[model samples]
Target: MVKSGQVSRQAGNNLASVMSRSVAKDVYTAIIEFVTNSYDADALIVKVQYNSIDDTLIIEDDGTGMDQEGIRNFYRIGDSEKIRNPFTAKGRRKIGKFGIGTTLLEYLAERYVMETWKDGKKITVREKFEGMGKGKGPEAVIEDDPGHISGTKITCRGTRFSKTGLDISALKKVLEWQVPCLPDFTVYVNRKPVSKRNLAASCIEYAFDEVIKDLGNVSGSIFYNKNDSEPLKATGIFIYVFGRSVGNPQGFYHLLPPSTVNRVVGMISADGLDDEISFDRGGFKQDSVKYHAVKKFISGVLESIIQDITYSKQKEPPRDKTDEIKEGIAIALKSAESELNKSLVNADGNINKNHPYRLELLLDEEIPWISRIDPKNNVIYINAYNPQLVVYSSKTNPTSALNVVFLTLAINALAEDQVGANNGNSDLFKRFAQTRMEVAKRLFSNFTPIGHYLKQQQGNDEQKAIAVSDVRLNPYRLYSIEDAAKLFGRDIDAVTRLYMAGTLRSCVKRRGIDRFRQEDILSCMSKIEGYIEIGSVSDILFPSDHESEGAAKHVLVNKIIDSRGNKPEYLKNVGSIAPLYFVKANNVEEFKRWYNGVE
Candidate 1:
């Protein structure tokens, strides 16, 4: 039997060892876990009060307060009572893997007290850092002390808070995307509840049609309200507006859907290693289910909203080879111009003029590229040393608003230079200028009408007009040149032309053909445009073909008279009537032979 004083000294040493181990690790993460534990408790309101005078942090939660036994189990260093699935009624799952988070407070505080009540029963736990190290049992330190409240309140002394002002705002920003909203739970730091007005809020709707196996049961719509609402269950999208749910699917814009995000799934194993092209477009792929879900969501949203105004399939009408080629060229010119103009603005908005950067662009693939900007000086430079495939936020300071303006300008200038190199007159530059003005015009023109429609539909409330951040574009299913070619069985050049033509319509007016002409024509064209939004000349050509001086066909095809002197060969292949004429061939030879012989 050891002496009583010796046993007490040994226990005190053990307690001190626990505190020392936890303090050696990340204290900031421990602070985060304390707040997250409140979330798991289904506590809507978590108030973090830092007493500067006392150098203490008081974290109090209105969650189901713990009983004496519950507190003993939950707060112990080696206790695994709370380490379970998160989808419980109380939603308890320990995010702190090491179970040493409670000890972290002991490192920061000289003395700590936890007072709690549950089911009309109250308990208090108090500890002096040095005393605990002197071999006092955990229960020996706790007692039925007075000043206990209905909820749990943890008071830590000897904390180092406010040598500088507390960054509650920044802390709230990180928490917004992580916490779930139950309408009852609200988190407040320094007596202030986290609000959306302080953070950059984007409520994006994500549509996940199905989930692949092996990723666990992580499928659910996540609506992220400004106050930390859970994502919508059906869409699986984390939506954030002014920080509240403004309805879903019906009220908000989608950022990503399921089909697009799936492409990023799958990891490269050691056996999957190849030659130098490992980082190129086809070389690497994502193996993670979570990444796939996110990628699909982003691609879906961008495809639906970003429109091309110049080429309307119904109004322009798809024709034979020459017309298709011409249309493709026109569309390509417009897209290049639109993209360049935006890049130029981005460059000019930020960065110093003298800052030198190189640009290495591979125009072979259509991928987003990056550009650098110094926002303070409003100068832009190109970066050539770093070979990045996609255009995204800058590495140094990604959140700068000037990054977009700077990138847009640099890219626009580069595009202009590349496209204008061959043409002395700088047709490409001219096209870029025209496309910029056109998009601007279209954007402004639709604003009033759209506002009126929105006012009628969702009311003129600013909240309703406010766009929610959602997964709007899905890249996997995006209609690219390759996809067009595969669908039409055409060559790459032909498909490129089709893409150009399609993009042209994005710059056009949204009004119907009747707005341009006296009467609408060819009912079939109207149906196609209505369903597909691809426009063509078939709407205006059929009825007026014979009446006009053949100027319409010439303007449509950008070509001279055909051998028949009535209709161009290309225009004939567009409608249902031409489907029978262009018979499918076994190979390119047969296709060329058949098309060349068309009268």
Candidate 2:
């Protein structure tokens, strides 16, 4: 005969005896777990104390505490009275659902002690860990308690964390986002009260109030912080089920543009999402309908908030491009003017008042060139209307790029004059190379933001440079342009650009062919080896452009050339030798900052 009987599911003794794997993830989680229990008890204030020096953690709260039976349920595995009673006696919605008990305190340390008082009764439980069967079960002792007030306190010694050292600031943020959004409830870390942090320095908020089709009422607020702070930035919106925080989605980074990533933070609470809450409570069940509803709803609103803020910024009044370009030109010229005036350009290889170096920025883009030089006049003509330059000026460091344009072209002009008079590249080691190198160094150091970084790195790099230069056995060594190009992993055009840009000087004439000394080329390579942050010639070579009335369609294609008027040597490999700017200065990003001075 077949027999029918009722069946029930149960967690094994060992399985239910431990805290949920999710709740025991870290000490912070443990703090959150305990704080949450306090909150569920209708505690208005919870204090969390962590003594890194002593490796101790203590959580104390004043609320309706547990009696002896409540203490028994606390140690019981897979059995939470919270599941049966949706609300506490005070009518506050319950936060704890999982009944996995005891292991969390052990996770904190090898030993645990918990105490509580309720209705003139006191119970204290102490648990010690040993090998499975050898471990002592939780020991509860009753004490005299006549005080009307009740509360709970959990204390642990020899805590499991020290490296993190219990960052109270981070814990403050966690308490704000991880716990329920309650105005009356407050959390304190190490006696310092946790408060809303960095939320008011240029902040905006978006609030929502609505009911999901099946997930019950959902309400919350999303905040945007303009402060550039690591601690202030929220990873994402925290999801709360009933009064318990479930997960942080981490969608804030991807939803907003890079400019606003991590600036957004929020919370979404649904009254009925118990089934959707993940086992660990770090997040939610991906396949659950209620979870999907919460996520989609939160993502949609968050994205809208980001778009609104981004759009407002775009709506601000924009400055005239021409005035901006002119201002950049003026600043760049002023920065290099004094040094350029002292440059070795006169007949005596020194300053010449009559022929002082000057930069002439012109909006005349009738010619397709970025720069032009007149030997008669000390003025260097920069086509402020160059189309490609206009594109670069819109970036962070237009003035720095412009300074490079003026200095490189000026050096090339000087090199053409002095080096042209001498037939041998060795003459540079004999005459102008040192002066030219010194002049290049001064001009770069004084003008570009990138130059400052190079100044810092030069000591380290220049020392190693001689070692690289030492690889050349002969002082009279000669390398054809193509040979030098191959050595530096560049193309013929790129090497030629460097030579004409005054970054590399030609050594001597062999069979009517121009050759460069390894030392000259080596120094240039060493300075730029790791400092190369430029790409196309247009990036640094050209940085000005102006629109001509009625000729908006006329786009000038930049073809950079030296003062001698020859095309820039094709750095077909390095993309037009633009990175061969004087001294191969520091990181370009820092240069941009120095040039812009955003602060």
Candidate 3:
């Protein structure tokens, strides 16, 4: 048992304990709090200095300084005059609200000295904190000081610095992002002024009002680097609330593709968001409905801008010859697919069956081949720009065009057989070249008589001379070893070896280069059957191969009959309608016998 003694009751506030508890989480927050307070006082110039060697931080501002009464009001916790009156004496908007700016100083250092002058009188105050925790109130001392400047100066000793110490560059960036458009306001780090350059000259502004409900007015500008100069250090659309930035400049989470992002930078301001700003002022209150509404509106507008830029880029003319060629190939392939499918049939006279081909064609001007067959994909890539194809198309009729398609299909079929085997044989390409040449020779021989007949029908010397000269004197009518290699889709060295081995003949020599005429090439090809063994029926057929030579001829005769669908009597004289190479028939029963026979 103990008797209760008379206790002296004392009522006091633990200012240090309160201030320590109010410590900011980061150095940047602590620094910005003081700078913002300066802005509230209508500061025109704010200077910050960090001395790593002495572990000290100092901030000096030329603003309306505090008097004795103002100093007492500033030391009050959680109560600020700015909260009652949100504007300054000079009619400028105020940033400080809860009188926590002094508390934030505890986060930067253990001790702080503040001095100010007002109405021709100067006063100084010093406060020291033990540590950042619940403890005794901070030790404070107040005194008069001889000072002439009419502003505020704060020095924080025993300051805490990050692992990299002071980053002046980062501080400058923060200042720029915070007060980029502030008029008559400037900040300096280590005596170097921080300023933001106006991009108005290179940018297009979009002024929008109340794009989203309760989001207030929205305005921004999209800027482009005309010379493709170095990319902006901070890219993306920066978001501002009132006049202060809410976060680091963002690229809208990198939504746009690099093509548009690299050329563009932007800034957006949303009015009335200051009320919804986060406590730390780092960003908006994410859960707030107004914040989400603002974000959604901004995102949609940025997406539209990106689409416009992308569409404009696409509208520009082709960048190079390669691009033009690619476009041409795409158009030609689409047209060819539409036309070729109407008449295309398989060796068994079935339409698009058993061989199911898909074609992919690309034009590569550097490829040393008039056309190449990528049999793995059943693609027949052609060089329509080839000198021979250009000349031939100019003078030929529809039948000649059909013959060219037939030759391409024949080569593709033969190549597909070899590619499907996957045997990895080096001589397979040579076999393919031999098959191409053999089929081309047969088609040319069958087509030549028709050309001569057409020439005779002209019955004019001028027309005859032009035709003869084109066949004889035109350089496009013949091929050098390199050109022949291109036409046959073989290596130049292999084709040259064929020339040396007496398997090919040169029609003439122009400029010391051996050139083979179309007629001479066809003659040489006719003799190749004796030198190279034909392994597949495709090696003989012009457009497609059958199970046997008889089957191929049957399909050709049937195709001819189908072409004359309007004339049913054409089948009565089958021999007259048949090509010269096909077996003649005097009656339908005889034709059926040949068509039905096994290999």
Write down the lDDT of every candidate, Cα atoms only: 0.39, 0.59, 0.55
Candidates 1 and 2, the one with greater TM-score:
2
TM-score per candidate, in order?
A: 0.38, 0.50, 0.48
Q: For all candidates, what are the clash counts? A: 110, 9, 2
lDDT of 1 by residue, 247-322 (tens): 1222223443333232111111111111111121112234644445434543444444222111222223455443
Candidate 1: what lDDT? 0.39
Output the lDDT of residue 129, model 2: 66
**Model 3, residue 359: what's the lDDT?**
34
How many pairs of residues collide in model 2? 9
Q: Give the alpha carbon lDDT tens digit for every residue of 241-299 in model 2.
A: 77566776574456667766667667667767877777677776778888778778877
> Candidates 2 and 3: which is better by TM-score?
2
- Summarize candidate 3's per-residue lDDT along 247-274 as a digit string, tens digits: 6565375777766665556667786677
Q: Which number leads on lDDT?
A: 2
**lDDT, residue 283, candidate 3:** 73
Model 2 residue 319 CA deviation (Å) reads 7.4
